[model samples]
Target: MQNLARAVLVLFGLLVLAVACIAVSIEGSEPSVPLTEEDVIGTWQGDRGARLEVTADGRARLSDASGWRCFKDGQAGVFTGEGSWIMAQHSDEGPGILVKFTVDGAPATQCSDHFAIHRADTRDGGDVWARWLGTGSKEPYRRTPTG
Candidate 1:
């Protein structure tokens, strides 16, 4: 009985910790600057070979990126494809984007997925933009990280 009671306590503690982590991720994701469409017009890279190229004319391309709203119909290899994006607003991260993915030039069904955006608070002020990949982790694809 004592061992079971200890296990319950441990599980409860873990649950609380998970919730706290989510809260922090959402709260601290505030944008450092007022993000515009032009601000995100650059190539943002993240860990694990993820690449998001945003062009000035509302074109976007993703390579090995996640938090995707497409590929719902057992579509494979569409992760690395062309798409279009527009400036959007997220409740947690404020200014965001909706990347409407496409598979070989056709819209990939309601690909209008919302993702968070943030800017790094650096001294260099390099106008870096970060795309929040709110999957199982909080990974940011920052553009031009300079010292």
Candidate 2:
């Protein structure tokens, strides 16, 4: 009876050790790296009828446009308006970019998965544009980001 109990204990210990080793091995495995500009260079289509293609050369073509725009080293667009531009991120709100161009006169901000456009003149009573790229029923073109 003693020998049988000892054998069972040893088997249980071995099983526990094996499980621990497997867990450690899984944890130590390399994690996946996020896609860089190269991976995202090609055109990407969203669930809605929107498409965006980012060029490795710093040009971005949005929504099947006829041509692309040069972003000038990630700082091409200018934000302009009145009240402080704000970017709503998480629960905390952040500063928004003031775009000055006539085409993109609306103030804007880039967040994790979306960009917002706000009118600076109104200050507190401006409209808030949400980034949705028209994926669902509502036709919104607020470009969201993906990791």
Candidate 3:
């Protein structure tokens, strides 16, 4: 009985440690250098037709830049709009970008979305931005060559 208990404890400890390591890798640390508005000014593309542009003038442009199953009002359509954005740094949130844009101007009828952008570590090239989708998930956007 004692041996079995010890083995179970050891396995649980190992499992916890593995999970912690994975969590750390997934929630990466702040960039080596703090992010700046100028640094993020460019075009970022992601899966689907999503594309985001951070202009030097503190504006953001979007093209098909919403979650999957894009909808307008009660209908369906891709999203495109322009809005203001800024580099935001909070003690708890670390460094991130807050983009507040609306899709009313687009041909689409009605829908809304917001973005909380953060830096994510990648295997190659520059760091990507993780656009949080509520508290459940995130979408990673990488800078494109043509943007």
Each model's C-alpha lDDT? Answer: 0.65, 0.36, 0.61
Candidate 1 lDDT over 54-95, as tens digits, reads 888888877776444355554433256677888888766577
| Each candidate: RMSD | 9.1, 16.5, 6.4
How far off is model 3, as Cα RMSD?
Answer: 6.4
Model 2 misplacement above 4 A: 1-36, 59-105, 112-147
Using alpha carbons, what is the TM-score of model 3? Answer: 0.55
Off by over 4 Å in 3: 1-28, 68-77, 90-93, 106-126, 135-137
4-97: candidate 3 lDDT, tens digit per residue = 9999999999999999999997666645656666556788786666788888888887776444333444344455666777777544556656
Q: Which portions of model 1 show Cα errors greater than 4 Å?
A: 1-32, 66-69, 74-78, 104-110, 120-129, 132-138, 145-147
Q: How would the candidate models be sorted by lDDT, starting from the highest?
A: 1, 3, 2
Q: Please, what are the lDDT tens digits per residue for candidate 2 over residues 40-115?
A: 3444454445554444454443443221122224432322112212222222322222211112332353211222
Residue 96 in model 1: shift from native, Å? 2.2
By summed lDDT, the worst window of 10 consecutive residues in model 3 runs over 108-117
